[model samples]
Target chain A: MTAFLRRRSLLQGLAGGAFVLVAPRALADLGSRLDAALAERFGERRPEQGGVELELSRLVENGNSVAVTVRASPDEPTPAALHLFMPRNPEPWGTSFQVAPPALAEFSTRIRLAGTQDVMAVAEWADGRLGATAVSVMVTLGACADDLYLEF
Target chain B: MRRALLLLWLLLALPGHAEPRAGQISGYHLLGEELQALQDDDFANPGMLWVDRGQRAWDAAAGASGTSCRDCHGGPERMQGLATQLPRWNSDQERLENLEGLIRNCRSARQQAEPPAYESDEMLALTTVIAHQSRGLPLAVAVDGPAADAFAAGRDAFARRRGQLDLSCADCHDRHAGARLRGETISAGMINGFPLYRLTWEGMGSRQRMIRWCNEAVRAEPLQPDTAKALALELFLAWRSRGLELESPAIRR
Candidate 1:
């Protein structure tokens, strides 16, 4: 009975430890971890997609470089920080911008998409509410990892 | 005296300036809203990827001296405003040297390192790091003094029409900067972003690469990136960007 109890305790500890280890990583990688990452950046409150206008082209000849713009509606409350995300990129979050009032609530930047994928941006307002939106981009040629072996 | 200077400036631009006292437009304004947003976003900006690589190269040691860039340059923050004054006159060599030329010189002379190819990854990485230092600093270049002759040469080149299309740099950039060409807005050829991350390349490339692409776009035989003519044109662009802020590691489509 004691042996069985010891083995059960050991398995319980291992399972708990696995949850601790895997949980953060599961939040780290992008596939769907965006919600978790957003929670970490903003808060636990989920954001509804609206109030934010994320703009870009529907198709790009090359995936290497593409332009994106994120803007809050003129009437919408200004956001505190703006962050962009690429769901399928090697790294999902591209970057963030801090908005200081009473400045224009508009922001723009350029980003690379891994492939034909959707790009998103979230604007966290001063009150902690978030306005989110996503744009679809099609890249013909994705970013290249320079083959240094061939060059050298 | 100010009026006299203005008259001279007017005369200088008259050959191609289409309008009197034509103001210059920075590349930032010429971009569509989508592009501007991408530039402002730090995380998704593909250019930052190059900047990160550059940060690594700066820390790594190279050359026969076994020294890294940090050993001599101190820190990147110290380099702020450095690029604003580049493509200047090097009186010691009596030549005009752009950022890349000076980079090659530094590698060969200071580090005793084999200089990188004109637009190699190492070269682009290092250049991007250096340029990132000058981010947000206003463009500033001395077109007079020892740089005068080169600036004049650059100005001459800007006005000289070439290529199979019979177009000069001035024809598009200076005269019709805001005009749309086949749906693309034309921008003044500003060199504020020397080592920019371009979408077409999907990686970092030097200002020389961008210039060469424009040269080819006009069906002109592009000058070598390291060539004297190219440096002279670079000087003109630097002078052109006098008041604009530097957005090195800038993103472009």
Candidate 2:
């Protein structure tokens, strides 16, 4: 009887441990995660729309790898850094990069989108002004969701 | 004279004697405009990441011998035009060996290390890096002598229809190459851009992985990777893709 009780307690303990490890990531809403990422990067700064251009195919056939380019208006001052966000992805923070001299305020990269959603890019200027733009992408296939291997 | 002409026409119409495709369509041209652009840009193409990884691994020492690939093969430039001639007859093993099989054998026998699995990151990187060197070369696998039997087997497999869909590779890739299926263009099933980064995969994959994926898509019995059947099919593909420029480590959707 004592051994059975001990085993039950151990099983409960393992389940609790597993929950603790997975809950934080699984439970957090994707939008909140994006907001959290933004807050972490730029505290107390609200970014204004425009002054930055985000270029990508509006209609995506496959959401695994999408080419994206974020460029600050050449007429405007070059931004200090660029931040990308994908709210529909598991992690909303796509990637961040610093913009330095000799290099323009434009950056191009390939990113994964979880589904159809608005992908945004924020550019932080030297004078603390934040400029942003978002593109609504219609993803035809969420290819990444399919597992690489499946049992016959 | 009439009998002789009929016999010649019949012989030409036979499956085994069917001439190779006179005009080949490259898989790259079949991609959507955006995907083509993505593949064009060095920075935007995700396959470059695997190439970068492979470049690093080229010089890194491994195994009991502590020898890098560079020690024997020299720089990756030495591998130029090599990918175009793969799935060749390996006399030492007394069997055909594809790029992945050759790499596996090299690592196991030469490096004295455990071989990387077919679709593993390490193997993909190595294959991508090596194949990237031969980019723009034409496919030219030998189809006679020791390779004849395998070529025949592969051609048979390509035409044989088995699966819930009852579709053969020729039914789609050969008969209707330019037609659209579910918003995606059906390519000629050319393999010049193998060891590529597929948007569907969200990562780099080998040609064997692509074959297995197609089999699953048609609800057919899965073809085990790196097997004799798989190697035969690869040799056949190489022959079919003859004259198509290599776009190894290409971006595909």
Candidate 3:
């Protein structure tokens, strides 16, 4: 059954015409869609990749509920808010939290992933600067609102 | 004749393959690091939500009697080591009954209230609280005397091949354990983690629901919930899990 799913995903990738050289164009489109959503929220401030740390498994067995943690480095400016995004998900915006002053810019929560996609986190500092990071998570099996049993 | 009796005694004392302890393995060790961490973290484990609900249900009074589980049985802590003996013979019902069945019986017979339907949130919550009490206790279900027939039936069910895939529960969980089945590793079909929170289900589930899912996966006709057959299978699974610590409300993929 696992082989069947792997074969099916490979076939899907091939059909998307990427020749397995890179990600399918559909995925690329979703990446841009994420960028657009991020732009709409953060507005012209391109979030950098190193200011904040996003902890997640590179490969997850089930995508239903995955534990994730985000922490802003101490050297970096204090973060005022944090936002999470998943491009391939039905909703590009995962969630957001406002960090009160004197509180640590670190938080942990569980989120659902759509499939093999990038999970991005953005942190807004008190100085109006934005820092972000994204991790590529390969969901072995996509379980976002999935049915429990398969009908033969 | 005395020598023959001595030989029978030795055979009876021998540790047979049916004893789960011989090669027993909990599903927890088979989990990936992430899931293991999740299960270990009481705050982060999603299954705790059900346990909390169960706790509430245990104290809240219901039915004509207005007696809560706590009023009679005190706290869930008092029920320690109780779950390990369940799916046992119920002389009142004159049939085998699991923890859920016992809960249902209490509700209808003692509390004078309609029992919650099988798989209902109320049922799952109540069962979780009781089973959670037995966490870390090894399964030690007795399958002798009046319970022997059900145990034999459960063993047969575990080995019986059904479904379109033509696979028995033992075929994958026993013979092919440790082998990769798709993205996941197959572990011995243990039931210690049940009433667990499964990522695939994204919610709490009873052992019967998990069994039904397995039956469906194999394309076999699932046994109806709360039936004699289902209880028999539960007995078999609990007995097969002998010596394995219970991890109720466990987090699983």
Clash number for each model: 19, 0, 1
Q: Predictions ranked by TM-score, top down?
A: 3, 2, 1
Model 1 residue A44 lDDT? 68
Model 1, span B107-166: residue lDDT tens: 899889999888888888878888888898988889898888888888889889998989
Q: Return whichever of 2 and 3 wins on lDDT.
A: 3
Misplaced by over 4 Å in model 2 are A1-49, A74-106, A122-132, A142-152, B1-23
Q: What lDDT, from 0 to 1, does candidate 1 have?
A: 0.74
Model 2, span A1-152: residue lDDT tens: 69999999999999999999877675466557767878888888878988888999998878777778889977788889888999888888888888899998888777888878889899898898998898999887522225545431
TM-score of chain B of each: 0.89, 0.91, 0.91
Over A70-103, each residue of candidate 1 has an lDDT whose tens digit, in order, gives 8886678777877888877877778888879787
Q: Rate the local accuracy (lDDT) of all candidates.
A: 0.74, 0.81, 0.82
Name the weakest run of 10 consecutive residues (lDDT summed) in model 3 chain A. A143-152
Please give, for residues A50-118, the per-residue lDDT of candidate 3 as tens digits: 788899999987888888998887788778988899898888899888898778888999899888888
Candidate 2 local lDDT, B1-253, one digit each (tens): 5345334433443444335563356667656678887788887688999999999888888888899999999998899988899989988777888888888888989999888877888999999999999998898999899989988988888888978989888877776555557667566788989888877767888888888887777778878877788888888888988988899888788
Task: Point to the candidate with the largest TM-score.
Answer: 3
Displacement of the residue A145 alpha carbon in candidate 1, Å: 24
Q: Give me the runs in candidate 1 sitting further than 4 Å from their true place.
A: A1-152, B1-21
Better of 1 and 3 by TM-score: 3
| Superposition TM-score, candidate 1 onto the true structure | 0.62
